[model samples]
Target: MSKKSPERTPPESLHLPRVGVETHAHLDSREFRDDLPQVLDRAAASGIAAMGQVFLGPEAYQANQALFDSHPEVFFLLGVHPTDADKFTDATLAAMDAAFASDARIKAMGEIGLDSYWKDVPPETQHRIFRAQLALARERDLRVVVHSRDAFAETLAVLDDMGFKDRPLLWHCFGGDEAIARELLSRGWLLSIPGPVTYSKNVELARAVAAVDMDRLVVETDCPYLTPEPWRGKRNEPALAVFTAARIAQLKGLSVEDAWRHMGQTAAKFFGLELPK
Candidate 1:
């Protein structure tokens, strides 16, 4: 009989925080459908003081609102994803506007922007919807969470053309290198790094995170996806945010506690949330 291989275990640091918050995660994801309570419990136990759920559509927005209402510790971002650009309509924008108008817990307008990775959604349509959402955010005076993939230049151009200079913009799951990062920093946009930074092949992203100023940086899990190493290919959750924080701490030459504290504070200020006393 062939010998079986031993199961790999995560490092001890995985369970210990140096400091962390999961700035963006999707609690409405099917991966957490069965054990959301348990997931949130794990997040709290893991020292995650706050979490932002990215709402993808009307259904997701409603579901996330209910979840956030049930768990005050969880916050949310309201927006339509670029892949769903074709779904944009007068009715849809009105619904989003109405939701933002009434929902105080909905912190920002995002996980919204351009994604040229999938050709299914045309670039022109994505640009149109993104501009519309930017306008909504400006009108509502809400911070914006942006998702730019394989269309960085165009994304920045739109922000410039739409005159979003004064608004607080968060570049979620940032994948660009130092040059792009510097450009964003110059424009006063914040960057949120996810689990991909921990992967061996993502040195460029890791460097970008390290190069960014702490005050302008935020950490995220982008859970149910981009699971950090050791847990790669496994379903991710907010608790995994610690790993990303730990790696960033290493890169920035700061203690885990300092990194987490800074990220938590930045997130709170950007999202206009009150930290638990």
Candidate 2:
């Protein structure tokens, strides 16, 4: 007898218990350029109701604006990434100001924070750009998605000195431990956890997730990256957010439905976006 191949599961086979939103993802990435439409279609099929695309560069900003204009469900965040600190020119700031001033779909300024992972960019330069963007977010009265890596202490110090207490700040793809979680929570900052929380070896993340209050938490894929377990190393999409929600739910002792609802509400409130009925 011939051995039979396993049955292939349909994309829709992943049943999501409740609707959720991806607060930060890079759909404008070159990785998704060719199959963007199909990726979004799969996301919708997986019960993703809303998505926030991070605009890392001028090109990404323009591409993100076009994507949001075409897809009402997709939103945008405008900012220069930490790795691109050198890219912040006067013209770039002007473009960002224009986007903030005129674009209703652009919800926040983000994916902009300190990253000490590379020594090529001096810490002073990172601080300068981060401070500038934080000030802009305050002046514009927009929420911010912060991307802190290996420089959380410095990042938090700058935010404190800048008086970011009144502004809504979210730590995107949070990789901190429980101590950092407590500190951020004490300051009323939101933690947006990615799919890495689902990995068994990510005990630190799970502990941090369980330690933080649910009301201050959100979910994201950070897609085309951090693909999560079961889908690791593959091109991640908003549809894969369900795995993130499920993992968080498991950590928090809440049902997947409740976790989804909590994340959707928290994101809506923070980004000032209306949730679809």
Regions of candidate 1 where Cα sits further than 4 Å from its true position: 1-19
Candidate 2 per-residue C-alpha lDDT over 1-277 given as tens digits, one digit per residue, 9 for 90 to 100: 9986544344355566435789998888789988898888888887777899888866677755666566778888888988889878778777888888888888889889999988778888889999988887888888888989899889899999998864688989997789989888888789999989978888888999998889999999998899876677677888888888878998899988788888998998888778765
lDDT of 1 by residue, 162-206 (tens): 887756999999888999999999888899988899888987888
TM-score of 1: 0.93
RMSD vs true structure, all candidates? 2.4, 3.0
TM-scores for the candidates: 0.93, 0.93
Lowest-lDDT window of 10 residues in candidate 1?
A: 10-19
Cα-based lDDT for every prediction: 0.84, 0.84
